[model samples]
Target: MRILISGASVAGPVLAYWLTRHGFSVTVVERAPALRKTGGHAVDLFRPAMDISEKMDVLPRIEELATGANRMTVHPESARRPVRADLTKIFSAASDRHVEIMRDDLSEIYYDATLGDVEYVFGDSITAISPDGEVRFENAAPRRFDLVVGADGLHSNVRRLVFGEESRFSTFIGAYLGVLTLPNTAGLDRELLIHVGVGRTAGMYGAPHLGDARALFLFRSERELDYHYRDVRRQKEFLREAFAGMHADVDHWLDELDRTPAFYFDSITQLRMDTWSQGRVTLVGDAGYCPGPAVGGSTTLGVVGAYVLAGELARADGDHERAFPAYERAMAEHVRASRGVALSAAKTLIPTSRLGVSGLAQGARLVSALPAGLSRAFLRLTTKSARLYNSMTIDDYPPSPAASSGRVGLGVE
Candidate 1:
């Protein structure tokens, strides 16, 4: 079967790897000119995602690239000293497992794993898709495929074209996030420092491996901001207005915002759809059911979704009629559970008032002061979002001849 996948990031490459292993001809089309190497924050790989990575033979590499910041310090606006928390313990209690790695590192590992086995069409995008599995691209010739899967991010072109207007299916969660790279002037080493202000949070942490520091910003908003998602100048202006005179650290970070080579800004929104498939064209990962952008375990959810989608297709002998529905059924409960956490995460991470910020700091201090065992138990008892990470079981599909053969290496030019 000839299968076409969109957005060669997290889900797309994983789907390509598994589909190719299941004896399907896979082609991936990415809008970017090349693999995106920067401008993304660190993402967690929970137990289920780790298991999938192990099966894909990339777990060791993932572990090697895991973020070294096992500690997190919270700086309150009124406090002279920051409250420190052990991130390792906090994350472990929420989910049985935790492997935090940079987003681009994970994508690079997945892309390298399947590069030789799949045909990647970079610097192009799908312009149109017909009901009969025909696809047209902006820079490539039109082609027909047995199936097309949209593993694209929140603003998916495939979802927009096949599922109609995105606004109808999108649920804004009243927040916005920005990330960029800057010089490591703070001299932080393997530690994360977060500053919390009224209804806003700004953080800077050192990335020794990359020889730079990363600045992360999050703020609350009642409604979605009106601006172009791709317009960097307008996005910077929006951020400047939202974070004006917030803190000395924020001002220092913003001083170099214009010089930063790449900057990412977007709203924290969720995509909810009654169905993710229309005929032979379907959706996976953020394109179909993104619980939340940064707060949600979106990367973990995407990896698991890609695995199940491909496994169901292989089980049904590449029959979309059977695979699509099965994929949805298997993912419905998990997706719903993950979405529930996003609502509370936004309020907790970015408090709405000065009192709320203090409350957050106090909570962190209380959690950090507890004994190791007590702390883990306390976090596990209070964090409902952590349980959602391992909510589903990944079924094993029989390996095909392609998978039994020697694996492929990075094939990029």
Candidate 2:
């Protein structure tokens, strides 16, 4: 059977990798002309995702490229002194073994790992997807495959094509987030700085590679703003208008945003679908069940979903009828918990009032000064609330019968 997977980020490439190993021909189609270098934010890969990576033999390579932050500093936008955030406490609060990496880095790793075996069609997308698994390309002739998977991100073209529409499954989470690379102003020594104020928060952190820094802007909004996703120029102007009069290098960052070639802006939204599969076409990762961006579990969910889909397909000998439903059943509860945690965390982390910023800073200070043992205890306590958002290890899924199969065909058919 031949599978055409959309999106080349975490889900598509990983799914292609596994499907190729499972005796199925796999091809990945990405909208970007090449491997996407710009990632919206850094994502955490918990135990389950990491286990998947290790099984793929990319865990050691990931560790070699790990960018470990020493501490996180929280500050009021009006103040200069920052309250140091405890690194130990933050990591411990997660109930899973976690590895933090930039989204693009992970994408690159997956792309490179599967380049030899998987067919990658760049600068293309699906304009139409038939119920019988025929894919119409935006820039190429129509093609047919036994199975089609949408591993695309939040605003997925495949999901829109296969399903009725994206709005039906999308739920706005009352927040907006923007992230982009900028000049390092705070001279951070592997520390992340988060500034908070009334209904707004901005964060700056040094990246893992290239001495450059990246900035994150988040704000609480109950109403939708007229924003264009493709126009980066307008997005910069919107950001400046939102934060017109701010202190501590606000305009400087805005100026940098105007010049930076890599910038990302989006509202916090999750796709909640009743079913991930329609006939032979299925959606994976954000296209199906986005647990919200930058709130954890998104990457892990993608990895676990890919692992299960591939395993189930192999278990059923490429029969998607038996595979898709089982894949959904295995991941449904975990997806619900992860999405709920993301919604809840966004409400808690982003301050609602000016005073709330100060409160959050004090809390960070307290956590930073807590004893090591107490810090671990607090992490354990908070992690339960996070559930699979914090713990995403797939130790339960044993070695599949498909594991022995190798050198599967990746022909387009």
Candidate 3:
């Protein structure tokens, strides 16, 4: 069984790793000339994802690279005195096991882990994918494989080629997220500073290991904004307008707009499809069913989805006819639960009114102020969605003899 996976960032490499371990030949294609090293922000991985990483022997590196953001200061726009919050307590209440790591770091860890075992092609992309596994690339000779998977992110090229335009299956979550990289500001080494207000919020944080920091913006909008995904100039203009008079500190942060090394902006949207598979191709992670962008536990979803898809293929003896359906079945509940939790998180984090903003700030203060035992219990009761990732249980699948030798046509592991 030979497999070709698209989008080498998070899920693509992970899926490739597991497939090779199951004795399949694997090749990964990435659009970036090399690993992307820009516009990354912190992403959380909960219990289930932690378990999977442990099985792959990458958890220790993940922990070593944790953002260590354990404290936060909230500056409410209403002139309320800033409130201090303990992130350690909030995360402990969210899950028994969790780590907040930079997206770029996480992607690199997985890519490095799978490097030797898989064939990775960078600086190229899939121009077309046929129903029978014939793939055409922009600068490489066409090749055919037994199966092709799209592990690409939100605007997956593979998804567009196979499943049609994204709007056909996307639902905007009434919000947008932007991130910028600049010299350290506000917080450092596990510290976070927030400027929160009704319908919009901004923050800056840095880690001791990083020479620079990141500025994050999350805001609510009644409708989608106008801008092309590739137009950096237009995106920067919109970002300036959105936070024009936010605060002196925010303006200071925005001053780096022209000089920042990297910037990221996108709508927080969800992908809902009746099915992720048709013929020999299927989708995984954000490419297939993104719960929602920043607010969603998309990092964890991507990890778990890749693991299950690989296990199913091995168990079915490389028969995607049997594997794809089983893979979807195993992940259905977790994906559904994650979507609900993400929606709630987006609304709560970026409130719709002044009162809502105060309540959100006070709620954080209350959670961090209580006794450890009491705070954990209170959080579990009032914020059940916070334990959203804890509700999932990982299934174990060992390498199998039933898997094909993978040397029939394309010689592989």
Candidate 4:
């Protein structure tokens, strides 16, 4: 079977790799002229996602690029001084195996792994999909595939083309997030310095290999903010208003917003769909059932989802009729758990009250102050409530040589 996957970020390339490994021909379509260089925020890969990466023989490289953000200094609203925390210990207790890699780095690793074996069509996007499996592209000629999967991000073109408007399935969870890339003037090395204010939080961090440091901002909003997602100017204004007078450091970080090289802002929204599949086309990763962005463990979910979707397709011998439903059944519990986690994080991580801000500080102190054994125990206890990514298991699907049919774009485009 020949499969075409849209959005060659995390899930698209992952699915393409596994599908071809299972002997099915695969092609990936990306709208960008080339790979994305946004250097997105750091993303966590828990035990299960790490296991998937290991099986692909890319774990070492992934670890090579891991963001060594091992320490945190938080200045809470009510606190007179900064409270320091050991992020290394907190991470160790959170999962048996974990790696926090920059999002763009992880995407590049996955994309590079599938280079020669997979067909990649950059600078084009899917415009339409017919029930008979005919996919129309904006730049390339129309092509037919046995299956089509949407691995695009939250603002997915594939999802919109198939499902109705995103608002129908998207729920605003009363929060917003912004990130900017600027010079690492604070001289933070493997450290995250943050200010925790009522209903908002701001941080700046940098890695050794990074040429510029990144400033992160998160805040709670009772109602959706009035601004277009593509309006960068409005986003900067809103972020400024939210974090105005937060602290000298944060104010300094915000001051560089106008000159930053790359900027990203979006609502911490969740997608709740009755079903991710319709006929011959189905959705995967954020394009389908994104629990939420930053706080949602979405990167892990996307990797695991791609692995499962590919495994199911191969297991059913390219029979998507069987594979699609099984894939949904497999991911249902994980999705539900992650959604709950996102909702909780929206309030906890970005506190809405002074009391919540203090709790956030005390919780960090407790984590850093505890012994190794006790810390892991406490983390496990707290994680049982928010650590669905670690508990979820990825089913094994060894490659089937008999599963592949024909190849597409074998030589050149």
What C-alpha lDDT do the candidate models reach, one value each? 0.86, 0.78, 0.87, 0.87
For model 1, residues 56-173, the per-residue Cα lDDT tens digits are 9999999888877777889988678888987766766667777888899999999999978999999999999987778999988999888899999999999999988889999998
- Flag clash pairs in model 3: 68-190
Off by over 4 Å in 4: 384-386, 404-413
CA shift at 221, candidate 3, in angstroms?
Answer: 1.2
Decreasing lDDT order of the candidates? 3, 4, 1, 2
Q: Clashing residue pairs in candidate 2, if any?
A: 48-392, 48-393, 93-379
**Clash count in backbone of candidate 3:** 1
Query: Ten-residue segment with the worst summed lDDT in candidate 3?
Result: 404-413
Task: Give the local distance difference test score of model 1.
Answer: 0.86
Residue-pair clash count for candidate 2: 3
- Model 3 accuracy (lDDT, Cα): 0.87
Worst 10 residues of 1 by lDDT: 404-413
**TM-score against truth, every candidate:** 0.94, 0.92, 0.96, 0.96
Local accuracy of candidate 2 as per-residue lDDT tens digits, 1-413: 78899999999989988887776778899999998887456777877788789989999878766667769877787776868786656665544477777788888898888978899999998888777667898898998888899999889888887787777988888888888887676687567877677777777777557467788888877787776678777877767877777655666777787667679898888888989998889998988999888763688889889988888877766777788998898889888888778866776578777677787788667656788677656656654444655454342444345445643323334
TM-score, model 4 to reference: 0.96
Question: What lDDT, from 0 to 1, does candidate 2 have?
Answer: 0.78
On TM-score, who's better, 1 or 4? 4
